[model samples]
Target: MNSTLSNNPAVVIGIDLAKTHCDVVGYDKNQKIVLKLPRISKEKLLERLTNMPRATVLMEACGGSHSFIRKVKALGHDGRLVNPGDVKRIRCGHQKNNMLDAAYIAWAWYIPGISFVAPKTQAQQDLQSLQRIYQGYMKTRIEFGNRIHALLLEYGLSSPQTSRFIAEQLPEFIETHTKDLTPLAEEALLMLRDSWLEASEWEKKAGQKYDELVRANEDSKRLMTIPGIGPKCAGALLTHCGEASRFRDSRQFAASLGLVPRQNSTGDRDTLGHITKRGPKHPRSMLVQGASALMIMADRLEGALGEWVRKIKASGKKYGVKVCAIAAKLALFCDTKDPTRTVNKKPTSAVTKVSGIFG
Candidate 1:
């Protein structure tokens, strides 16, 4: 410990959480640095924190940070997680190191109006873990499918569009094309097909796991009530957002997930660009993919949501633009509807308002 001269106990401490070690900095009530310990081993760090007087512990919300926060809570300290991006904006100079990052994290808390991230409960993290596993399986399935498609393309044989269809038709197609494909291509195709089959099966199981998680979670169930938002989308949204109360309103929630447009506005003029795309990629993807489903069948949809979708289509925007428009609207709708799954029961006004702008 690079302990300072003052004897008063620290009232605030910032920790730069690394995988195996952490850099820690502390400040007393008088805004004086009281403690500085760089590259402390994880075990010794916990012991140090446990012995210290109760103080607000700050750390960037990174990998393992939440679990560390839980441990700190067990030791009877007030633990807070700050966004790493926020810390960067407040950080001093271009120079960076573990100690500097720790000091910045602590000072970031001292700065007024800096927001804090809500620490996810163990249960939320568990659900999110399952969702992440599902994402991995899906990615594997897609990757293998693409490889299969490319391989078949090389042999002048078209693959079936869907994974299940491809799995079923592959053998017959291979037999029929035996005269065309080289032995090496046949061997490669067979190997890729088996991998794709394994991945597709795992993907289905992962989806089933998602359904199991959704069934157990009231929030996920409520979210699934919206058309085109299945267990997968519901799971992704909950995994990313955690809770609706974390946000002030639907727009803020949407903006938090980067569903809103970027702005480069001057006093005299306002300009907006593409979506910021600033948060977790998976949830935003689920929203837009679900919106594509709704857009393709918008005519069959009814009520305010349908009307909004239809009007957006009527505006002659491209499919991609329409899907994003609907996704943003859907994000807003999801925020207003979840947690209690009450209040803002009808999305008519929100739907009409956003549709009018985009349409």
Candidate 2:
């Protein structure tokens, strides 16, 4: 790791990061390649950047990019995480390598109208990790449950629809049907049932941890004030949105959540389509699910939100579209609040205001 490059401080530095090594390229103010370092270890890369004069650092938004940006910022450099798609659009030539990608990332930073991804805080990353863990556990549990159900069906046995039904009634069902099933088939069913039970327990434990994480975060607590938003939904929103203030207004915020409609227009003619579905799917799905839950209980809602829901229902739009529209509205409502505002105490008034609508 040479310190000469740091002492000279290029105008912009781009990094293409991988698990074990990073490709780095630097450009001077005139867009000339002033520095090139390929396949540098993570520690070496950090060492070379340390104590460097402040300069802009750019990287494609990818796994570990957030953490890398944090390191660069600590060294007094401005950090920007550009979307990979944006970088790809600007990349030149068909032949691509880490060095070229890094150079492209730096050039992409200077492109007009390029969108940069906000670097997530450590806390946000932690919440996202918890959410991913919970999702993984739930997915595995469902797969196991499905396998058990299919196995039983193949043997002419019908299982109850309830989630816990298999765990509770499996032993009895197995015993009674042992004569009907071959020894190997019976053993496989029992094994699958046991695996399903284990997965269910793991899923429950993950859910508890996710709830605890959300409850401990102040942003998540305030998010829960929104109608139909529970700990999981709140956590997902907080993790994804980071700071509501980043968006200029509620509409932009909702669009970032992929709640806004896609547009296609040419020569004065206009066409609108479904949502672009551009962002993380989990939080977007969670918002839609929350909106659906709210619609299910709309009769109990009394105020503006409830009335709005009724109006949408009366409009004759498909149920899915209505849910998406409401989810967008909910996102806008969330964006109206300041993320930095201290809401250490329970959000009683906020909850009451929302509850009043339903009442």
Among these predicted structures, which one has the highest TM-score? Answer: 2
lDDT of each: 0.79, 0.79
Name the 10 consecutive residues with the lowest summed lDDT in model 1. 350-359
For model 2, the superposed segments whose C-alpha errors exceed 4 Å read 1-8, 337-359
How many pairs in model 1 have backbone atoms within 3 A of each other, for residues 3 or more apart or on separate chains, i.e. clashes?
0
Candidate 2: C-alpha RMSD to true structure equals 4.5
Clashes in each model (backbone N, CA, C under 3 Å)? 0, 5
TM-scores for every candidate against the unseen true structure? 0.87, 0.90
**Displacement of the residue 207 alpha carbon in candidate 1, Å:** 1.2
Give the alpha carbon lDDT tens digit for every residue of 110-224 in model 2: 7887778989999999889888888898999889888888888898888885776777878787888887778898889888878888888988999999899889876666678
Candidate 1: what lDDT?
A: 0.79
lDDT of 1 by residue, 162-252 (tens): 8666688887888888998998998887898888888878888887877897778766666676677888887787777764566776777
In the predicted model 2, the residue pairs found to clash are: 300-358, 301-358, 302-357, 302-358, 303-357
